[model samples]
Target: MSIFSGLQPPEAFAEAALALGPAPLVACHNDADGLSAGAILVKTLQRLGTEPSTRIVGKGENAYSDAFLDELRGRAMTGLVVTDLGVSSRLPDLGLPTVLIDHHVPTGVPTHACVVSGIEDDPIPTSSLLAYRCAKAIGVETGDLLWLAAIGLIGDMADEDGFPEMEEARALGITALRKAVSLVNAPRRTASGDASAALGLLLKADGAKAVLSGAHAETAALLQAKEEVKAALDAARKIGPKVSAEVALIPFSSPCQIHPLVAQAWRTRIRDRIVIAANFGYREGWVHFAARTGEDRDLIAFLAEHRPPGAGEEYGNGHRLASGGALRLADWNHFVHAIGFGPELEAAA
Candidate 1:
């Protein structure tokens, strides 16, 4: 029999999740969607058999990063399940059965791994919903977990995708789910970029109400994170953008991950140009930026044309219209120059 009972990539992925046995390490991204997905798998794994260990890939770290893979080495894991992290052939060979569950456009899919991608879906399913399907295929009663997937849908702004489950969840309480998502997203946006508290709340909370009830200590942490991020965002929003004919570059330095929000804030206002929000202070020795365009331009191809030498997988790796990346100071300077910006925004070497 096939490991996933002869199903295809995605359906097989759900089945593989159920079969990946003894002890698998579930590595997930550190955003609201990622954490919710991880939480679902963690819950499902617990109900199935032995509990699975989980690693939340946070700021400046990816599942295949050397530091991350080093942490996985020598662990007594029998399998690996990765969610929400972007797919790439750079996936390290850890000599174990692996499954990748994601919605990001794949640059390359590892041949040895089972990839469940909803990237081509008209309305892409978030990793949380994908993990929920895994839970169902495991034959566990997942009525409670449906709301968990709803939390991710709202977090990723897919609440309007019109999935029946989303409507059912909305009837449960959209306001609460929205609030919980913001809270969950806040911790990882802060300078510390630690999402442990957010993950902790998701892992144990019975539902959205439990997440926001102020009943758990982690809830307080999330609230504080929200306040910190809001202040940072307000400060970033105050700065004006340097507009060119075709692109608007809004450059600000902050410890918060506010570049995406800043770019989003400008995409509507500028309407005629691609809005690039660059945050040079989010991490040391790197410039992180997000690109948003009002038009239907293919940003990934646009970025590839002006690609910087130092740009890695972090560059132009998201959806075609909505993508961004990190570049070293030198490469960022090269990028700004290549895009027709003068020396004013270039970093001092």
Candidate 2:
């Protein structure tokens, strides 16, 4: 069972992959999953005799923005392939054919684009796995890259083990988790190139050892980030547990901006309760929130039900268990009270 077992790529995708002789522009996100998806697509394109030109979205930016559109317009491309990103509310018509392979909740549907997303019925699979299956469907032999999909799955924290679609990806040992972490943190460790060098490494590396060994700085950064998160979680654990409450809140303030990863780690430690961790940067007059909750306390649904002041629906988006968004400094107290957090608790201990 492949993650893409029954799902089919859009007709435009197959036409562009097979008939369009010119190389395609593959724009992807900078995260580990996005890089993995980008690498898989790059390999598939090369095997089909067309080398793809890869572009990465910057941190804290959406995939479809004015700058990105301007860059796309400058390229002499025949077709476009977007993976692990396409949640933009405003997608400009690029005139050229496009393929969107992603699992994120779409903000708006693009015209003249073939979207391959897992929004309605099927279990969400990482864009990397989806792209690999799409490549295979188009007659590219991608047998060796099944393990790569596992890396994306781990990086995205998308554990679809029980789902029928992820049978093959789940079969691959979870060793890629460490490698995924390295790939994710590499860009954060360096000021320049962000995920550019790391994406190149992933695309060219022979195996997990090659990637992990090459990402020394990234691994160290990840370790430090984890330690910081552990410290925060440990302090939160000392706070009295609320057995009657549906959610547990951990508000923190740190110089480092790693709320999403910290929120995930905190969720793992307190799986029995819904976890909401807010990282406040008072200087910026905003607080970024990362929440983890089960189906009973679906984070996405809660975000949808409660719109933060001065923010749109697009501001809060992600999976069922994990979601994130930001709020203004003025709204912080209101948001906290809305989520049932008391005012007396100290944000940082």
Candidate 3:
């Protein structure tokens, strides 16, 4: 049965996955949870006797973009599985069979694909968890994949949600799992933004210890990437926030993707206001920001109200409490000015 967080029926999504031919493309986001989900999907498809091709959608890349479509067209593929990346409301229909597995708050429903979303579930399951369930529903060897679900759980900060799967996986070893998550997440957050090392580890490792055992070359790469991001974060953390009304904006520039970590670090101290950590150096010509709030307010709605004209579908698309987006320098200027920050706060053109 297709339990995919208990929202979809058994026939809803599994049928679509089963319909796909041998050469299906699995496109997933570049993160610990996303990579874990991709690995799970790979194992599932392999069990079904198909050799699937996996692609990592790095930061700033969209799976549904025209460029992505063009790339997909160039490949000889019969099916597609998109995971972790948020979907466009007006999702385009891929001609071949498709299955979308995700847990983010979707903007709209896709009419053409089997969407296995966990948005409705209380304490929503992460993408890897959903993939695990889907694998189980289709009658695969999920017993060995439990630790993967645990890695995604710890990575997404949902380890405290108390899922039985987590408890079971924890028995295998939680420290290694958490460390594996940090290592697996490191490569994607570095300046290179290549998560192949992390994904490769997930694809081959039998368990959490196997990932951190230093037995594979991928493990060394992951460790190096973690140290790189750590240095960048140390420099960015020294800068404090500039508060305005209920918003506490901490603006800094870093090549590493540490804005989310910065926002989270300051989130507790600025418990009364929304914490926004904006980074100008993560990507050229754009400002990347992460919003976190201790206040029980709808950050998505908050962003919608203050969203600058230039902000596209990329903005305000994550969870209600923690959401962020990238904006061009010009649009970012408008956003900061509108939010009552001065010109000095705007991204330099």
Best by TM-score: 3
Identify the superior model by lDDT, candidate 1 or candidate 2.
1
Span of ten consecutive residues with least summed lDDT in model 2: 3-12
Candidate 3's C-alpha runs over 4 A off are 1-11
> What lDDT does model 1 reach?
0.86
lDDT of 1 by residue, 1-349 (tens): 3222211344575567766788989898889899999999888888888669988888888676677778888678989989999888888888888888888878777887888877766688898988887777768778889888998898888889977778888877888898899899998899899999999999889999999999999999999999999999999999999977678999999989989989999999988888999998998898999999999898988899999988888888888778899898999999998887998888665
TM-score for candidate 1, residues paired by index: 0.95
Candidate 1: where are CA atoms >4 Å away?
A: 1-9
lDDT of 2 by residue, 1-349 (tens): 5433223353335555664346888888777778888888888888888868998875445566577678788889878888887554366577877778887776666656667765554566778767766776777776667666667766765655454334665554456555554556456323232566667767766556656664444444444544554564455444443322567766666534456656666677776777776666422566767788643666777776666576743356777777877666556666666666666532331
Clashes of 1: 0
TM-score of each candidate structure, all chains considered together: 0.95, 0.76, 0.96
* Local distance difference test values of all predictions, in order: 0.86, 0.64, 0.86
Runs with alpha carbons beyond 4 Å of true place in candidate 2? 1-12, 16-23, 70-76, 86-89, 158-193, 213-247, 255-257, 268-273, 282-285, 328-334, 340-349
Better of 2 and 3 by lDDT: 3
